[model samples]
Target: MADILSILLSDSFWAAALRIATPLIFGVLGALLCERSGVLNLGIEGIFVAGAMTGWLAVWMGAPLWLGVLAAALAGAGFGLIHAILTVPLGLSQHVSGLGVTMLATSVAYFTYRTALPDVTSPPRITPFQPLDIPLLSDLPFVGPVLFQQTALTWLALGCVFLVWYVLNRMSLGVALRAVGDNPDAVDAQGLSVYGLRIGAVMAGSALMALGGAFLTMSAFDAFFFGMVNGRGWICIALVIFASWRPGKALLGALLFGAFDAFQVRLQTEVGAMVPGQVFLMAPYILSIIALVVAARGADYPRALLTPWFKGQR
Candidate 1:
């Protein structure tokens, strides 16, 4: 018990929590954007895998690290367009379209990976981005090590939380977006294009989602492997609900989940003999389930979330 308490109080645990939460922040922000605009994108999982593959491949092929990130974002945007086509103009079920997107993206990534490197016994790896310690901030006691000692992408993820909130609450475009999600017919009546807004939102949101995946390969790990994402995308979905669709809350939620994951790792190492490994592994996911149940009450989802909008349909 004393050792566990000491571990929890140490700076290393908090730093690990931030590291674990970084990718999740990207994913949750992306999911939040899509859901806010009335699209529930289950395709996040596949997009994540695709981003990881594409970004790593770019870096492996001699492109700059930032370019690899761009490639991932673009690939994600392309997938989002496919989803928009299926769910927006074609008016297909969002649930079906999203799941289909996930399957299609993951399969394509797997096929490409196999075709590109069929005989390799060892996975190809690239030089991943190292942590860029902030100058003065990193010198601060406790806080600096925990927050400032992260990769560039992690810092960007933190900035995005504020950027998303600003755009959603203080921008005109955000108003139209929220309006479209709540009532597309009303938005259309006011001379705005519902299809355009939703498509834009989904594509933009998906690009961010892809960036999250790219972070996995380009920063979190130097190599891309099958199942590397390991359901972080799905966790982002739960996080959206747990956050009640708010960006600030999403950050807090992601941090909480990250803490659990970090603690689980510590537990595995420190108390492995007393507790089963599986319990530690499952701790984060179990907490997510509990969060979902707790946050569901009074949750205000977009009114037109699953409903396809038609020009004149009542």
Candidate 2:
């Protein structure tokens, strides 16, 4: 009890929790946006891989960091566009389309990596983003260490949460997007293009998903590796439901999972021999599943989700 309490109360724990949640924040927000617009992007896993690879590769090949980020976003958007075209206008199975996209994107990224480095056994590393010194904030006690000692990418993820919330709640564009998701016929009746809104949302949402991958390579670590995404994309899909499609709640869910993961790491260090290491690894996921089941009970999902919306169809 004392050891666990000490870990929970430590500033470093919270800092690590936030850092671990950074990629999730971006991923959940992306999934939320896609679902809001009536699209389910199971391709998120592949997009994450592609983003991490492309972003890191760009930086390694002499492009600037931000440009590498752009390359990642663009790569994600391209894959997203493929999924959108297949499902939105074509009215295909959203599940099949999304899964296809995952395979396609993953294959492309892996192929590119192997093609680029035919003989290299080790993945190359790039210069990652350094933590910003937030002046006075960096010097504060617990609060400073917890909130201010993160890379710019972490802050960017936080900012994106606010931006997504605002756009979804406060803007007219958000209104249409939500409407399109709930009832595309209604949105189309109001002179809005249902196809356009859904496609655009998927593309934009996918861009955000890729950014999550970028964070892995550009902020969390300097090198990209196979399996580095480690199912974070799938977790995001569930977290969106756990969040009930709300940005603020989505952030909380991500953070909670982050804390669980961070705590498990500490717990492993404290009693690695007593318990199997795999149990510690599974703790956060098991806890998250419980939370998801509880929160998802009353989750009011988009009405038109998974329903094909063909423009002009009565």
Candidate 3:
């Protein structure tokens, strides 16, 4: 109990939790946006790999860091466009198209990495984002390290929470986006282009998803590794359902998972190998699953999610 209390009381633990939550914030927001517009982007997993590889590659090739983020976003948008075209206009199976995009993006990223660095045995590294050191705030007893000391990208992720929430809740575009997701026929009756709205949301949401991947390579670590993304993308998908499609709840869900993750890492060290390391590794995921099951019971999903609409269809 004492050890657990110490772990929770330490400022470093909370800081690490926030850091761990950053990528999920971006990812869940992206997934939320897509779902809000009646789209499910199962391609997020592959897009994450592509973003991590391409963003790191861009920096290694000497582009500015922010520019590398842009490169990643554009790459994600391109794949999203493919998914949008197939599902929206052609009215193909969204699930199949999304899964195809995932496989395609993952393969392309891996092939590009091998082709670009054929002779290298070890992945190269670049300078990563450093945490901010606010003079007064960073010196505060507890609050300093917990909030003011994150890297720029972490701040950006937090800012995006507010941005996404505001846009989804307080704007006309958000209203239309939400409406189209719930009842496309009604939106179409009002003369709005359902195809265009859905396509745009998927593209923009995908762009945000790529930024999460960029955060992995640029802020969390200096170099990219195969499988580094693991299953964060899928976790974000479940988080959207857990959040009931609300951005604020999405942030809370991500932070809760982050706290669980960070706690397990510390607990693993404290137990000193008495418990198998795998147990600690799986703890966060198991907890997240429990939370998802609980919250998903009452989740209000977008009605048109998975239903395809065609022009002039009655």
Per-model TM-score versus the true fold: 0.97, 0.98, 0.98
Candidate 1 C-alpha lDDT tens digits along 1-314: 89889888988899999889988998999999998889889899999999999999999989999999999999999999999889988889998899999999999988998899999878988999888887999999988889888889899899999999999999999999899889898899999999999999999889889988999999989988999988889899989998988899999999999988998898788769998788877787788888888888978898889888887787
Tens digits of lDDT, candidate 3, 245-307: 999999998998888899889988999569888888777667768878997778888999989
On residues 168-198, what C-alpha lDDT tens digit does candidate 2 reach at each position? 9999999999998999999999999999999
Cα deviation at 150, candidate 3, in Å, is: 0.7
Q: What lDDT does each candidate get?
A: 0.90, 0.91, 0.90
Cα displacement (angstroms), candidate 1, residue 58, comes to 0.6
Model 3 ranges with Cα > 4 A deviation = none
Model 3 scores worst on lDDT over the 10 consecutive residues at: 280-289
TM-score of 2: 0.98
Report how far residue 38 has shifted in candidate 2, in Å. 0.7
- Per lDDT, the best of the predicted structures is 2
Report clashes for each candidate as comma-separated counts.
0, 0, 0
